[model samples]
Target: MPKNAKKKRTQNYKKQIGQVPGALIYTGAKEGNKLHLHVFDYNNEDYKEGDLDSVEEAFRFKDSETVTWFNLNGLNFVNEIETIGNHYKLHPLILEDIVNTSQRPKIDTYQDYIFIVLKMMYYDDSEKIISEQVSLVLGKNYVLTFQEAEGDVFNSVRQRIKTKKGRIRSEGADYLLYALIDAIVDHYYAIIETMGNKIEDLEDDLFTGLTQEEIAQQIQNLKREVLKIRRAIFPLREIINRLEKNENGLIKEKTTHFFRDVYDHVIQVTETLDIYREMIWSLMDMYMTTISNKMNEVMKVLTIIATIFIPLTFIAGIYGMNFANMPELQYKYGYYIVWIVMIVVLVGMLVYFKRKKWL
Candidate 1:
């Protein structure tokens, strides 16, 4: 019975993990494709580079004193990641959270390490928004970062660590961890800046008398992007704030201030998102007003045309009858006289419309 229960449990776990085959994972590949591993070791005055094709190779040089940063670039692997976690004594729940990419930004503290997951969003070359999950594990002497795929925006931190510039090399792994997080939060500003530009463009288009349908579509598009960014940044703010106030020694007291800086950035992002949401609502209202005004103008023109032609049509219809006693038809200049009368009436109506300011 115990063996059967164990098999059932294993099957359930496998089923859950298999739901999203394209989801990001913390481990290296086993059957399909493997990810590249980058390891960086640094102290106050000494720094070393260790790039490996395998996760095992990256962890082989780990020491207790110096800070080691291991970056895993791909997440298609399962067994290799399990192996690495086994070597480091990582919590299984933390591994599960890292494998699930749709998780909200959160920080979980374990007995020996702290696990954090954040979403990194960028605009690709085709102007499409791309989002990837970034998982971070902070331990006593090392920081391990895992990404969905390669080509992240954290190259600046890597460069700083390599050059031993600033207080990065002198600080503990906690500070380096702070730097990595700060870097992620900093890139969020670029996205906000781009959104600001889009808002400005939308405002200009509206003022230039954009069509109602066009403005409505643009509002929908902008709102979607704003909501997407809001979803990505709001939880991140909570997560970073928690990290700032957390009493864990893994995040040093000195680095908590830097984490505060990240918290402030989150505040800015939240404000910007609110502003964009309001602007989209305003655009929606503007679209409705513009459409209504246009419809009113069309109806006004049609009413004026009908009003002017009503009398003229009556006069023509009376003269057009084939009655024998129609005296106006027998007159010598009847057709010319009717033309003059109609022209005079038409001009009078035009003058009245002009005076009423309805033209």
Candidate 2:
């Protein structure tokens, strides 16, 4: 076909270049869950929980005295997120990060609030790891949490707040921040534990038999999963360090200790991730070694077969040649003698092989 005969591309492509900063570009799925604002306004005396009818209904909690948690699910609706940001007086960059699901775990301090982003990871029904970006904005008496999807690991924290099970009701918004993050960190244990089980299973599978091709892909997928965990959770250590030394006054002195506890959990998770990383890498080599050993056993049997046949084949070949002056042809019992000699040689070789344990 000539150059002009080719057809133009019909695929729809979204342009990403030359875009202005602070633009609300929802990079998540186009058909995600609708925007839901689950508001929790609670104090030491009373607790209220409900969903907002519209985005405008959440504006009243901006300056309320009670600690309010605005759990906003779904980032696909840029307009709704923009309205909430405008009402809260959040920075343009903060709004940008709210809808940008690719943002890494980080902490940014502002005059009146603190903006933090972290990954929330969990296993689906099929035991596959799924990571969602969660951006948290902590003010004096409110905490705004934005998620890419509806499901999260903060249900236990919500239960605690509703039942007044602990000091969450009496604490400030900083403590609420700690509680939510602690929930996320606590779930990390389950994720790592599941991965540990998988690694152990792979170890056993590789050791018990020659399964190079059988579980090769399994090891690969598990290795990728561990890397995802490392990327999702390791950067949290720096964020916690910032909270400990930050003098923004939004995080109370008592709350800093709680953050430190979460920091300790983060350290443990990262260390375990490091160990998993090494184990996953070694799994590939172990699989290859198993394959090599399998090949060696096969080659050893073949070599023994060839070694036993060499002398027998030589004797037969020598007798098979025809010549008029051959002395064996003139003997009366030459055929019987040759048969006995071959049988004796075969039995002797078999005995020697058995004694050497070559079988």
Candidate 3:
């Protein structure tokens, strides 16, 4: 994530404090963004799709016999969203959670609908992970999705519904909700696969002793990405588990099986994330160990050089003393003999170190 974007999100979170619980203040950073309203009304026989100019157009679908999918792209417009919420009889807390993009992934059951908050993640053009919050309300005959921005992983689901390629059009709102969530969860595999590749690439060069000093930083960033994905998908596991087992009227008994499949996928994602998290920790430890080993090699070489000089220094110190009875100082070739002796001692130490395999 970009540092600026992260800072902005954190700052926005501060605005939510000391406020009413059900207040419709938008805590997301997408302010001043124009709202995009798209409605997908479909059935087994036919479908109608269009962009609405106002939230009032969505009111007609309140009692729609067919499955209506009201996909609102931007969440900054509090007035428009409020109108939709009021018309649809959504709880105020549900509306608040929908606008609060920082909310966790959760499932809140109501008398008229099932509200689910999910984190939809995908890569931007720069390959940076972008997490968008998607709030869903599944009613008896309609499904409303609120998003922070425009892009999503729901294109395939839309294509399926549009082409009648599968049973989505023939199913009720619960199945639509399932398809939407399944899309997000299925994309999790792609994100996880990307992180796995990163981990493998790092590990490939980690032990070579030729990696750059920034390799540790790379591992740290990778760990953050893994943790981010974990935070997004871990809560989802519990949410899906609860959804699959709930006896709510909005969720059909038959649809529980599909949700069960989704739950399995979430479990796989969380398990992979756990493995990656551990691998990251191991990488950090290995990096530190490598640094320590290199430092020891350096210290060993310096120690050996100092030890070799210790004897020469002792001999030189004894001869450097001012004394009238120094016999070696009176000899003409004494300096040459001392040089030879020092060289021999150095060579002997070198040979001994080599035999000891300490060089």
For model 1, give the 10-residue run with minimal summed lDDT.
22-31
TM-score of 1: 0.87
TM-score of 3: 0.92
Tens-place lDDT per residue, model 1, 144-259, is 98786777878889899888778999998889888888887777787778877877787777777777456676778788888887888888777877777777677878788888
What would the per-residue lDDT of candidate 2 be over residues 286-316, giving only the tens digit for each residue?
9888888889999989988788788888888
Clashing residue pairs in candidate 1 (N, C-alpha, C atoms within 3 angstroms):
27-81, 28-77, 29-77
Question: lDDT scores for all predictions?
Answer: 0.79, 0.89, 0.89
For this target, which candidate reaches the highest TM-score against the unseen true structure? 3
Model 3: CA > 4 A from native: 1-13
Candidate 1 achieves a global lDDT of: 0.79
Model 2 TM-score relative to the real fold = 0.91
* TM-score-better candidate, 1 vs 3: 3
lDDT of 3 by residue, 80-198 (tens): 88989999989999999999988889999877788999999987777689999999998999999999888899999999989999899999999999999999998999998988888
Q: Please report the candidate that would top lDDT against the real structure.
A: 3
Local error of candidate 2 at residue 336 (angstroms):
5.3
